[model samples]
Target: MASMDVSLKEMMAIDGAVGAVVVDYNSGMALGSLGGSKDLDLQIAAAGNTEVVKAKLRTMESLGLKDTIEDILITLNTQYHIIRPLTGRSGKGLFLYLALDRARGNLALARHNMRIIEEKLEV
Candidate 1:
């Protein structure tokens, strides 16, 4: 099993990745963060993304969906924001947030890498 530190470091290796954070969306708090830009504070980003996660959860509940969220993606002009929820027991109630430059990111690969990271992460 990979420790949380190792998993996060692996996340930073993804091409175009600028920052990554493990967050508790339920609490709007970051468990850890790496490589954030001065223009974007990781703390503020984590807090705001909590609303996105909550809204989707509310919608899913209303729809009576039984499945869990694997990940969520938000595309912007210059960046792609990926939020991946951990399915492993050790990572319960937590998610990984990754920021990648759109020009350099391979979305499919990034998603696959995130799945791998989530699988190995020990929380």
Candidate 2:
């Protein structure tokens, strides 16, 4: 199993990856991060994304959907943002955020790899 540091590093290696962070959804704080440029404040992004996760959870509860969220994809004009909540026992309350250049990213492959990383991540 990979440690959190290793997982974040591996995420940064993905094609078109611009930023990556492991965040606490409950607190909206990044536990770890890498690859964000000055233009991208990953800390702020992490906090904002926490709200997104919370909103989805509230929606799911209201809908009576017992299923867990796999991931949330937000496609912007030039970028693709992926928010994946960690499901492992030790990873509860945490999530991973990945930003990719839309033109260069392979969304399917990225999602697949993120799942793998999440599975192996050692909280």
Candidate 3:
């Protein structure tokens, strides 16, 4: 399995990738982050995304849906944000967030790669 650093590095290698981070939704704190700056602040993004994850989790509970979120995708005018909660029991409460250039990214492939990355992440 890959370590957090390796995993984040691997994520950055994806085509069109701009930034990636592993965050804690409960505390809205990013434990690890790579890329994004100047106009894009990853810490702020991570905190905001914590709310997004919480809202989705709450909605799922209310609906009594037994499905877990594979990933949350937000399509913006110029970028696509992918939020993936680590499924490994050891990594519960943590999530992987990836930002990509919508015009340069292949959504399907990126999702697949993200899954692979999650599966291999050691933490």
lDDT of each: 0.90, 0.95, 0.94
Any residue pairs clashing in model 3, and if so which?
none
Q: What is candidate 2's lDDT per residue for 2-121, written digit by digit as tens?
A: 999999999999999999999999999999999888878999999999999999999999999999999999999989999999999999999999999888889999999999999999
Question: For model 2, what is the C-alpha lDDT against the true structure?
Answer: 0.95
Question: Residue-wise lDDT of candidate 3 within 1-123, one digit each (tens)?
Answer: 999999999999999999999998999999899999687799999999999999999999999999999999999999999999999997899999999988888889999999999999987
- Model 3 error, position 92 (Å): 0.4
What lDDT score is found at residue 121 in candidate 2?
98
Lowest-sum lDDT 10-residue window in model 1: 85-94
lDDT of 1 by residue, 10-121 (tens): 9999998988999998899999988888876889889888899889999999999998998999999999999998888878888999999899989899999999999888
RMSD in angstroms, candidate 1? 0.8
Winner on lDDT between 1 and 2 is 2
Model 2 collision count: 0
Task: Tell me model 3's lDDT, rounded to 2 decimals.
Answer: 0.94
Task: Give the RMSD in angstroms, all C-alphas superposed, for model 3.
Answer: 0.7
| Window of ten residues with lowest summed lDDT in model 3 | 31-40
